[model samples]
Target chain A: MSNWQWFHRLGSPRWFYYKTEGWVPWLAAVSGILLVLGTVWGLAFAPPDYQQGNSYRIIYLHVPAAFLALIGYYVMAVAGAVGMIWRMKMAFVVMKSAAPIGAALTFLSLVTGAIWGKPTWGTWWEWDARITSMLILLFLYLGIMALQAAFQSRDAADKASALLALIGTVNIPIIYKSVDWWHTLHQPATLKLTSAPTIHSSMLYPLLTMILAFYIFYALVLILYTRAEILRREGRTQWVIDLVKEEAKKP
Target chain B: MHPVRRQRLFFILFIVFFSSVAVGLMAFALRDNINLFYPPSMIVAGEVPLDRRIRAGGCVRPGSVSRDRETLETTFLLTDGIVDFRVHYTGILPDLFAEGEAAVVNGELRADGGFYATQVLAKHDEKYMPPEVAETMAAVSDGHDESCEVVQYGS
Candidate 1:
């Protein structure tokens, strides 16, 4: 199929839903396996830091959760952008589905960061640049969710939230660069794409693995969430009715 | 291109412009509220206002950490290698806090030129858990080893 042909096909909720169904179980299995493996390797095999002791193990969860939180905002914003431009239903579905997971991951990152902070930073919370920007990110996610719900029509909700997502995209850079921009209690980045990582290979490998696991986990969870959204939005359609009947007949 | 398509292009541009404006406003608002902390050099230069709560950080000068046995109060010299100042805390320091380590102290700057610290953070680096003990906690319960040992450190 041509690239644009596939794009048109994705506009149909039923087509997107059916297409994604076969992909979810496999994604779930892979994510679950990788998450368990990465966590165990990080918490067990990865040597502790020379300084922080056992408390640094929270990195296995915190880094990945924080990574996905920023990434999810982009995913949501791009999807919103596409949906607005081409009016693709699947794109909007992807945007809507991304909100809760983004919020949840952002919340996880903040909580884990706080927990990790107590022993290292000496305070449960600091109004440091990174910390404050992350708080705004959480607010953006929550704001999108609240906006999506407040509108009476799905179309209105999609457009309003999409606008908000685009606005929030600006914050991700500020959050990522907060340490560099401000002299706060937070340290400079441990990992950099352009240069060598500050961490050892033994530890860095598990953290990288965790990052992969979290991204896959996001895709798997987003697919499931989108499928539910598809069913909800298309409940009156024949395809959904037939799907329900088929499932009923099977069991 | 059709006028309709041109209008759509204009709409996308409008969204971008709108977002930038909003972010710019937030950044402008954040500037004054966020610049509450100053480095040790700035503090020593008398840049920070006295009698107000302020934050400062530097290396915990080696051999400068002293504790009172009865009061459990600890005092350490905070230095940025150029300018140095003293920080006094009446509570336990962070686990990662040590001499020659980067630390941030927040408290009131007293009339006596000393910082009476209310909080002390290791600040710069996060010390990690031990990796030498590769096995799970089960290995410890099985009495394989008492605790994880430190290997050669790079940093």
Candidate 2:
């Protein structure tokens, strides 16, 4: 098949729904295994930071979720752009699916950050630069989700939310650069691709594993979410009816 | 241009206009509220205003800490190597508070030039230097302790 042919097939909801079934179980298993192993390695086996003691263990969940929260915004913005520019139905589904997951992760990052800060910073919250920018990120996610819900027509919801996502793209860099641009209580990043990572190999390895696992986990969850969205939107179609009948016949 | 492409371009322009205006508003608000804290060196240069609430941060200079036996009030000199200043805080300090580690002390600057701190955020951990304190230290060229040394300062 031609490249364009394969591309068109990807936009087909029926092809996606049927094709993804065989892959979901495998993705779920891999995410589960890596999460378990990384959790054990980071929480139990990894040596404590000579400074923060066991309190530093919060890095295992906090860093991965924070990293993913930032990436999720980019993902949402790109999906919205594609949905708007190309008028692709699947793109909108992907874009809509990203909002709540991104919101949840942002919430996770903020709460974990506060818990980690309490023993170290002597306070649970501060209006510091990094903290404020992160709070804005969470608000952006909530805004996207709420905007989509407020519209009565689905098409209108898709277009308006897409616009909001694009407009909010500017905040991503601000969140990433807050520590550099302003005085903040947050520490500098541990993992940098430009230079060597700051952490020890014993700690870094588990962290890298957890990060990779989170990416895989994101893909797995996104696929599941998009598939459910596809079904709800396309339930009136013939293929869905046939598929449901086929399942009934099989049982 | 085709009508579909024209609509998309309009959307792109709209986003650009909206972002610039939004960012400008955020900046103005930030300017009023943002006293991101002054380094000890800024105080040494006599640049800090003593009227409003402001922040100053750095490493707690070694051998400079003292506590009153009865009141539990603590006093110490905060330093970024090039300049040193005193901080008198009455609250309980965090567990990770230590000498040689970086910290930020937030309060008003007194007439005696000492910081009368209401809150003292010590280095959360031995390895963790709050980026603000690290920035103050970097201004003096003796930039880091263990936590920030490996970090490349700018992108």
Highest DockQ against the true fold, candidate? 1
Candidate number with greatest TM-score? 1
Query: Candidate 1 lDDT, tens digit per residue, A46-158?
Result: 87765666788898899899999999999999899888777777888899999999999999999999998988778889988889889999999999999988999989999
Model 2 interface CAPRI class: acceptable
Q: Which ten-residue region of model 1 chain A has the weakest summed lDDT?
A: A180-189
lDDT of candidate 1 over B31-149, digit per residue (tens):
74665367777778887789888888777776789999999999988776667788889998887787766778889887777899998887645323344532353365321111111
Native contact fraction per model: 0.50, 0.33
Pairs that clash in candidate 2: none
Error of 2 at B148 (Å): 8.4
- State in Å the error of residue A172, model 2: 0.8
TM-score, prediction 1:
0.89
**DockQ for candidate 1, C-alpha atoms:** 0.34
lDDT of 2 by residue, A1-251 (tens): 48579768878888889999999999999999999999999889887765677888889899899999999998988888878877888888889889888999999999999998999788888888778889999998899999888999988999998888888888887788766666667776778768777676778888888998898898898899889889888999999888778888985
